[model samples]
Target: MSVNRRSILRTTAQLATLTAAGGLLTGCGQEAATGGGAAASEHPAHPSPTPGAPTVLTPNRIPAATPSAAVSGAPSAESAGASPSAPEQPPLAANTPAEVISGPSDRPQVALTFHGQGDPRLATALLTAAEQHGAKVTVLVVGSWLDQQPQMARRILDGGHELGNHTLNHLDISSLSADQAYAEIAGCADRIKALTGSIGRWFRPSAAQFATARVKAQARKAGYEHCLSYGLDPRDYADPGAEVIQRRMLGSIKPGSIVALHMGHQGTVDALPAVLEALQQRGLSAVTASQLCS
Candidate 1:
């Protein structure tokens, strides 16, 4: 077909594909710097898959950030109110060097990391499924999500899953200025620390799979020793069928690999069992990013 028509068809397909996510998705996302939707300067080899939220928590949760509160580049949310007591955490990631991508190739373990937002019920379902299969995953939550669903912070930890920060508003962190980026990182981190007795362990940049140097620096300032990235991406946030998610994961995942998934979709919840089963078949245990990296 003509180039114009092809472009139109592609756009239409993307729109059609997104229809099912109506009001369901909150958003999150990567593998390398290479391929999905982010600007080339943002991620080079693997483009990010889920590219908004950039927040799907909607405008209802809270202001993406309080501009004034964020100006000092300090976390203001910690003093908001009393937070729940957190459960004992899993073995934390002590490695302070390099980006956390995958684990040692010789080990039979892989990490499943989720961009956490969307319906709490769905998030719970996915977590339950993972736990049932004797798996543990990492959840990098958007700050605003916790504002709306504060209880989830404790619930995630209670389930033996490792919780991390995915920024306060889930914005395109790579595109933000230093102060703004710091606010995003520290903002959510403060919330995590307040709710869970710690800022969790890792920081995964929202809207992008990889963290830019600036983002890494900002995360360090916010108390993260290691930034988390992923080696495998099934694009579960795209609302692709559970089979597609399962197929993509089974086909691409490897030992010591970190797989990126999302918490807001039903397809992801449905795909959990089969994905876990496939991993079991391959003798790979699903673990947290800290577990894999450390």
Candidate 2:
């Protein structure tokens, strides 16, 4: 799961050169989920299961211009836009990975992240634990949730953790049209920008669902490199009990890990203290997703 700096530099150089050439290089790249090409020409494929862990899946590599055939419903915000007079949400600022602050690597470091609609109680618990432990955790807020819970969103920003965009209404990006997908992403960026006066740089598509090269390209164009998870995830989203959540997280966490847990889950909240304590005992310093990307 660890990609050395030389490899990262090489890939980054290639990506940068490609960007200068126009957009991303057009070609078919295999989807990790099905171990098959996710090109528009191929049929839709499911994400492949991680070795020895049903909950964890392999990381996806973004491809250029390879259109995916996936489909899904429209974002909730667009539907709400039936009234043109609706106030526009603030725009998100651009976040390029080159700007991120790198953290300690000689010592173990992991970023604990929460996904989904932000809940007040869950946010309180997450922020409180992080503050009490001096841990820096990344919170990927849904645009609708942020607009609904502005006060909570403000608290998250005030606390000094990096805020990332998690698309409006949690629609799967693979299912939306290119324009629709860009809107879903850009809308959130705009709203977040309106709130914090900065565009969002890190974007995590709902369900890690980037089915087409176009989807990934759209995200990059919006000033984000699709955030990829480093640590294998345990499915806390399904409401797996607290013990199970803790057990799964503790089982696979390692250095440079991007551990994922869901927000709005009571069980995860309950398990968090134990998880944080374990992280402390193991000397894994917590950080934001942005910090890890660089």
Candidate 3:
């Protein structure tokens, strides 16, 4: 089932209320992060598999860099001490695909993506669990959130996971004007580049589950090749019971599914062990979105 704009806005409001009441229990970060949704096309384009069988492309590997070093042209040190200049980044490739809904269906692999904004402790816990289970995930971080916890960018990359952009303030890009959308995309990308020495590996629209074509173009101009969208959403943002979250994910996942999850929700953190276990039991491995797409 697709999540419409109205429901997404309502959920955002509910999350805000819960946070203000201190009733929302999130994983180990400073505060609870919220989510937004958008209506999606019934049949968005997906990566095509090879004839007769899915082509298993080797995952692209970018060596993790030191936290002190910048990925782009930003200054290397944010401290008072003298530091070495960061290396310049190579120009990004052009003609990247505008969107990717899922990886090749022939592989027994799924990508788990977390929308980040909430508790760093919880985010660390999730990353640790994924590593323990021989899995990697993609974290789409909000730009403003990164500004609050700049270290998270390095922490995520340090764990062998990939990072992506989720806009500046997590507002719905579809409703914004073209220039506003570009600002959101560029703002987040700037943060990612400043912290990681490169723009994010992907761009997922904020406040909306799927990116509009206009937003996609903006993201492309900002340096992201693919506008990432999920094929499986367990609605972890709703704070369903841990068991429910686990069951829904374990029951719904399929080959090449990109599972959308959230950061800062205790239920999601609690449910992840079982979900990872179930994936392993089924001979499916959890991978980063970039890996799945690659």
Candidate 4:
């Protein structure tokens, strides 16, 4: 994925245009997620699901506002993530996109992502694989899953992994009505916020690789500047053997690629070591989605 001149200019302009007053995130636009309107984009708009992915600038971080209370007994660190000490991204301008699929190809990094809701042991095992290989990952979790496994939230952020919303029920978000879809997104956000201080960072629509325009709009209303999409889907969820998953990922991965995997499967956990080794062989670092996209 070569850098697009237009995207670079757009990024520069967006950075320059951010009002000193707008703060980290702007309010939701007039367009409703379920109601019809043009889809919002940050950069490299209307990207295809194919390999030629977009090269994006650093996306803004989630609003640094008070976390909405949803659960109690959360530790201070979980209430306020450890990563906030890092430099903050500039505020988003009006009409930022509701989805992001890839990052700047100029960097030799790839993001390994998981859809949360699996065996806790398996989840920790996957994280161990990444940590052992000196990698970081992103987890987009279902809101209700967090409700069941609140400790996992602290474990994820503590392990230097990114956490985001994957909707409440992990349902077919695109097909739901506007109100239902926003609930799916905001519901998870509240859950994440209850356990983790920030409202997480990114939102990914469930049961879909790419968000529909309506889903994007709904995500925006839910306070997500971008709904995360992936550039690579090795289909680890298919329960193929570890070797098959490894082969598919190594065969198709590229710089700035966001590779989607799942938990609850031993094969995916088994495949991580080889995949991380293969990534090293290809001179690609396994980074969090925030690092890759930023």
Candidate 5:
């Protein structure tokens, strides 16, 4: 359940092999900045500029000065001129503005977000439990995880949960080149569409580590509404005791807040019953991430 720092590094090397073979690596995150298992080497320390590469900032949004030559590689024509072969896309399909759908008055209505590597039974158990409460949770389905457990993903959809893109590999977007970042997100989106005929709306930066403005801009360019965390760090990756998980979640209850949990932990499953019971007591209902946005 808990991968050590050394184990994480070893796993990352294995992941690189999969990537080289054109396989997707999803759901492999390590806590670095916020105990979310964000590996320092996983993402590049500085941003690279590649013309035609997707970037969070642009001349329209930021200053007109061109990105440095070193950061920006050879400019692709698309960066300067439009191509006739390019397909037109809807605004929302590519980039939607971020929103917090708070209602007129305060009530316990919020979305729960989970982060972790893949486990088939864990996904199924979470879906079944959520369905029992008639609640919807948003799952940031990673490409690697999906490739390994497509059946489980179908179950998430069947149970009425929303699927969001968690990236091809769980690399920190802040550390990847603009084009690499685009490929990570776009590749995942492509896989999801091929499998489910649905496009993702929400994107949670790996480990919720949004260190660079460019990464955020790149997300917008890639057509994802950025998902920022609000409260209830259940720290499921750490394998907290069920009692401790329940207490932290109960203490952090708030309307319109997004609770962070992991899909790989049995402790999370063990704590869910109590969490659900408490939510019912407080007159709250968990909705999918998209529903919360709506």
Candidate 6:
């Protein structure tokens, strides 16, 4: 299905039900597969980065805070309440810059980013293809999707890629009030932190595809320095044939471009090999968004 704003909003309720149901199914499958017991340690906590070692900064080139520190800065769910126009407070003083449209133009690299809330198999396929081609891409995951398949976060991180937030339920932040907006951003950040020991490196507003000033501020408050937007969108969510997707992406790509693709679509999975090959032919390497920006 095409995932334009109107369609996303229209299907929001249905998607919520699907996500919840999927989570239950996933939990059951895990129990059965693991002999009906939770592993003693599923995801081990990531150790603190060694001092003087290079850290992965947000696209704005700002250092990210520890997950605990970031969560502390965000408004608590209880504080968010039910009001729409809750007074906006400035995020913590340590908040990073707001948005990053594209990375530095001087490099012969581009970032391929996927917005995922679909089949985990397709995500694995996409990641496998990138790895085969000596590439790494960014994945901005939906919180509910992660709730369904928490292991996907570890898969992304373990593959030496990056992950970020795409909100809890793919809501259009533009239509939401400040308090509600903070919940969406922070809610997803909380999920990422639980799995990966920190919120993923970037935040991208869902459904609307671009962040409003208020939304950006909320995201910053949630500890994301970069609100990632794309320079190239292949519209893979539309399920255009693989050939069309490959053509549009290759045609639109430039040095430092951030290309937006989607998960759940077989076409995107099919298109990736050619797309990566085309990038090589153009002497442009595909990298994680932070790597492209850095």
Best by lDDT: 1
For model 2, what is the alpha-carbon lDDT of residue 21?
Answer: 64
For all candidates in order, the CA lDDT equals: 0.71, 0.57, 0.68, 0.69, 0.56, 0.68
lDDT of 3 by residue, 1-294 (tens): 357988999899999998966733332322211111121212232111111221211112112222222223222225312222332322333533567777778989899998876777888888888888999898988766665567777778778888888875565467777666776677667667666667766889865678888988888777777898888888777777799999888888899899988877778888998899999999999988767766
For each of the candidates, give the backbone clash count: 12, 17, 6, 2, 14, 0
- Point out where model 5 deviates above 4 Å: 1-105, 209-211
Models ranked on TM-score = 1, 4, 3, 6, 5, 2
Worst 10 residues of 6 by lDDT: 33-42
- Candidate 2, residue 66: how far the Cα is off, in Å: 23
True-vs-predicted CA distance for residue 118, candidate 2, Å: 4.1
| Residue-level error in angstroms, candidate 1, position 217 | 0.9
Model 4 C-alpha lDDT versus the unseen true structure: 0.69
Per-residue lDDT tens digits for candidate 2, residues 1-294, read: 357978999999998897866632322222211111111200123121111211211122222111221112112223333222222223322543322223335547787876745357776786777778788777776655655555555566667676777665455567667766665566566555555555445677765623357667777766675544344577776677889989998998877677666666678788888888899899887776655544
- Return the number of clashes found in candidate 4: 2
Q: Could you list the CA RMSD of all candidates, in the order they appear?
A: 19.4, 17.2, 20.2, 16.7, 18.5, 20.3
**Pairs with steric clashes in candidate 4:** 79-197, 98-227
Instruction: Judging by lDDT, tell me the better candidate of 3 and 4.
Output: 4
Candidate 5 global CA lDDT score: 0.56
CA error at residue 57 for candidate 5, angstroms: 26
TM-score of each prediction: 0.72, 0.63, 0.70, 0.70, 0.64, 0.68
lDDT of 2 at 173: 68
Model 4 Cα lDDT, one tens digit per residue, 222-267: 7887878998887777677999999999998998788888876789
User: For model 2, what is the error of residue 209's alpha carbon versus the real structure, in angstroms, after optimal superposition?
Assistant: 5.4
* Clashes, model 3: 6
The residue pairs that clash in candidate 3, if any, are 28-122, 29-119, 29-120, 70-197, 71-197, 72-197
Off by over 4 Å in 6: 1-97
